[model samples]
Target: MPPRSDSDNVGFLVADVTRLLRAEMDRRITAAGLELNPGDARTLSHAARCGSVRQNLLAERIGVEAMTVSSSLDRLEVLGLIERQADSVDRRAKLVHVTQAGEAMLESMQPLAAGLGAEAAKGIAPADWQRFLDTLKHVRANLTAARDQLRKENAAA
Candidate 1:
């Protein structure tokens, strides 16, 4: 393959790092005998943090499709890690919440979650690391807004 242009490097580097971090997490999670795959870990963890949340909103928070989240929720529900119930206010919607068992699962994954990005910048000064994480959050917010706008436009058609 031809050499990648410098212009493409930033996105590529970010993507590579994401892939590597996930691979490491997967390895650790498996070794720990956790039943959840990475996606399930995320779904359960988010539910634990957010309390009861609508399935659609959970999908948005995790940057995944509603159907994908639904599938994971189905499996998690079977595993007794989550409970999905009809939304109290919106009968048409489902709200998912973690069960007591799920709380234990989230506790198990905490170490892996806490370590995810810290390893990549092991030597970086703490301030720079904080700034970099803050910048990434800003970028994520901007991208999420643009994505929501696009979704709104498409849904109006």
Candidate 2:
């Protein structure tokens, strides 16, 4: 078989879309002269959405490296966007929460994010759009399960 094109592969297509979305978000933040970059915005957004989540869990949910999330959180904390408190159950781990300032910032960014989503789905009908989103969520759940199983198998080996 001839070598496959990157645009024709599921993994490559997903990565391309993700890169485009993030790049647009980065551009909007920079254009707005926001103090935080895309990385910090994402970290803060996740914290606000998840509500007092463990750092590792937030990193896992965001699909980023632990150090990447940690670095973002550090910058966000300095900017008063997020705060890390000692986890009550896990002594070694910290729980991250978005501050009021973070929420305000997120409120300001929400319109931009919604606009991006709308732009991404511009030509799609409402029914198809919801179905597509549902499909993506299902695919994500399956992939997460597969990843967890792989990790368990690797640990056992």
Candidate 3:
């Protein structure tokens, strides 16, 4: 069996792609005159997608620190783009929801995002793109399951 180089490793390739994509997205967002920075934009997007998620959970979903999400939420609330309401089940916890303004902002950014996606897929055929996405999803599922198993084992130790 031959050892794989960094460029040929799945993890390295995925990380490189993710880093490049995020950098490019940030650049485009800035060039488009969007008021939000990449981190805030990402937080809002995830919050909107999750629909009334807890602050901590939203942070976990977005792979950011709780304080980072908290700061973004503060700015978003000030802009009237999102609101937080007391959770019925846990008074100490708040659930974040995107306001109408937030939805409007997301809609405005849709074309920018779609254009970037098209650019990234320029050399790939539609079928190949779909297959690539499917494979990525499968890989994500496998990794998630393994992570869950590790957490359980750690908790039991």
Ranking under lDDT, best-scoring first? Answer: 3, 2, 1
Clashing pairs in 1: none
Candidate 2, backbone clash total: 0
lDDT of 3 by residue, 1-157 (tens): 8966768588788889899888988888888888898888888899999998999999999998999999999999998999999999999999999999999989987888898899999999999999999999999999999999999999999
State in Å the error of residue 77, model 3: 0.7
Model 2, 1-157: lDDT tens per residue? Answer: 9986777588988899999999998888778778888778888888888999999999998999999999999999998888899998988999998889999999889888998999999999999999999999999999989999999999999
Judged by whole-model lDDT over C-alpha atoms, candidate 2 comes out at: 0.90
Model 2: how far is 97 from its true place, Å? 0.8
Answer with 1 or 2, whichever has the higher TM-score: 2
lDDT of 1: 0.87
Instruction: List, residue by residue over 1-157, the lDDT tens digit for candidate 1.
Output: 9976784576887888778887888887887788988788878877887899999999988889999999999999999999999998999999998999998888888887678667777999999999998998998899989998999999999
Best by lDDT: 3
- Roughly what TM-score does model 3 have, to 2 decimal places? 0.91
Better of 1 and 2 by lDDT: 2
TM-score of each: 0.76, 0.85, 0.91
**What's the count of clashing pairs in each model shown?**
0, 0, 0
